[model samples]
Target: MKSGSGLKDRLVAQARAEGFVDCRICRPWDVPQVPARLEAFLRAGYHGQMEWMAERTHWRGDPAKLWPEARSVIMLAESYTPEGDPTGILAHPDRGAISVYARNKDYHDLVKKRLKRLARWLIAEAGGEVKVFVDTAPVPEKALGHAAGLGWQGKHTNLVSRDWGNWAFLGSVFSTLELPADDVEVDHCGSCRACLDACPTDAFPAPYQLDARRCISYLTIEHKGPVEEELRGKLGNRIYGCDDCLAACPWNKFAVAASDMRYAARDDLNAPVLAELAALDDAAFRAKFSGSPIKRIGRDRFVRNVLYAIGNSGLTTLVPVAQALTDDPDPTVADAARWAAEQLS
Candidate 1:
């Protein structure tokens, strides 16, 4: 088996060849602070409806506890920087704003395939047991990414890289082979509260902390029922996920477009008209969002979000679109339609 600095160098080279922008290694025990932070977040009910965070606290909080046999954690960064300003779409009330990340193909599918390829190469070259994970697992990927020197968890609580900024997807590879860990990154967000102040719904309670319940991303994607009445107005035209805080990061000036074309924004999804999106039936919704991450939210919940955007749009032309769904089979969708109609009326 190839072991040492030579093998580590080869691993990084292979990762780049596989299209990862950055790669680094860290031990499973590197993120000792995760457990306490997670405990605080869960205790404060900041996780919102994500009960999975509490279900596997032991594994989610500590990587060493997740798999003791794993000697090293390989963190890979895949950049997906949008070609244009992701926040600009919010100004066009007639258009619905999808988060930059969801404007293309699902990162989970793309990143997972890349991780598996790296895992296969590692097994062949380093001859060790390997397990690959994207976002599906309970792994503390952002914490591990910081520990691996890929980036630090910025004030936004998202992994922010000096080289890639905050517009990257993270994947982890656990291995039995021992590898040299990189130096941990320190926070560089000195006196910069841009991300905190940029939030439309005031999701951040303080630097390095976030309240998911108040986040537009959580409201549009994760929250099951209709969103809180007060918060719905703050959503604006952002129907899928919100990127205001991410776009506010100053470090993005140094960021580059994704090397993978799959991450590029789709033409249809780029500032899609709210009336057209709200009119999509279940079949059309699935067909339009096929192979996209937005499909996970399903049509009913998706239309519910569009209704919120329509209400906030003030585009009286969308009244009939909202009126048509006033009797939607889904109660949440029906309630959203009524609310949107009231706003437009």
Candidate 2:
């Protein structure tokens, strides 16, 4: 079996050929800082309704504990940078703005497939046992990515690379082989607050800290039931997830084109009309987002978000549409619809 620099070099080459933008390695226990930061965030209730985060603290805080046999972590980045300005749809309030990442196929499936293939290649070439992850588990991907020298966690608390920018999906392979670890990436945000300043709901309490309760993405995607009336207006036309902070980042200027065409925006999803999105019934919503990440939120929550967007749109033409849903079977959807109708009135 190949070992040392030769094996690591070939593994990186194989990853690039598999469509990953960058690949690096780190020791499983490299991130000593995660436990405390995670504890603080959970204590402050910043994770909001994501109780899973608190539930999996032991594993999430340390990769070494998650898999004791794993000696090295192979972290990889796959670019999904949008073709045009993702924020452009915000100008058209009558339209719903879906996050760039959710514009097409589910990234979890795409990135995981690639990670598994890479893991297979690693085992074949180096005879190492491996396990791959792509956001499904309680993995601290960003921390591992930083430790692997993929990028620094930016002020927005997302991984940001000087080479690939902030528009990438992170995946990891945990291996029993002790490959050489890379130097950690240092923070380059240095006084740049573009991400923090651009948040419509001021989700960031400070640099590198996010308050998910006030975050549009969290409200639209994770939060169950009706969002607080005070924050609903701030949601604007973003019906699925928010990207204002990501779009405003200066590092994105270096973002490479997505290697997979599946990541490209679908015309129907790019800037869908708010009224059309609000009209999605369960079957229609499932069919529309069949293979997409947006399907997980389900129709009721999705339409609830649409109603909030309709309220913020200031488009009185949508009043009837909102009124129609005021009697929706889903109480949350009904609440949102009534709120939207009142806002339009």
Candidate 2, position 37, lDDT? 99
Instruction: Assess every candidate by TM-score.
Output: 0.98, 0.99
Q: Score residue 146 of candidate 1 by CA lDDT.
A: 96
lDDT of 1 by residue, 1-345 (tens): 225988899999999999898999999999999999999999999989988879989999988988888999999999899998888898899999999889889999999999999999999987989889999999999999999999899999998988888999999999999988899998989899999999999999989999999999999999999898999999999999999999999999888679889888899898798889988999999999999999999999999999999999988998999999999999999999999999999
Cα deviation of 98, candidate 1, in Å: 0.3
Q: What is the C-alpha RMSD of each candidate to the true structure, in Å?
A: 1.0, 1.0
Query: Global lDDT for candidate 1?
Result: 0.93
Query: Which tens-of-lDDT digit does each residue in 229-318 have in candidate 2?
Result: 889989888999988888888998899999999999999998898888888899999999999999999999999999998998888999
Q: In candidate 2, residue 70 scores what lDDT?
A: 90
Error of 1 at 268 (Å): 0.7
The C-alpha lDDT values of all candidates are 0.93, 0.93
Q: After superposition, how far is residue 209 of candidate 1 from its true place, in Å?
A: 0.5
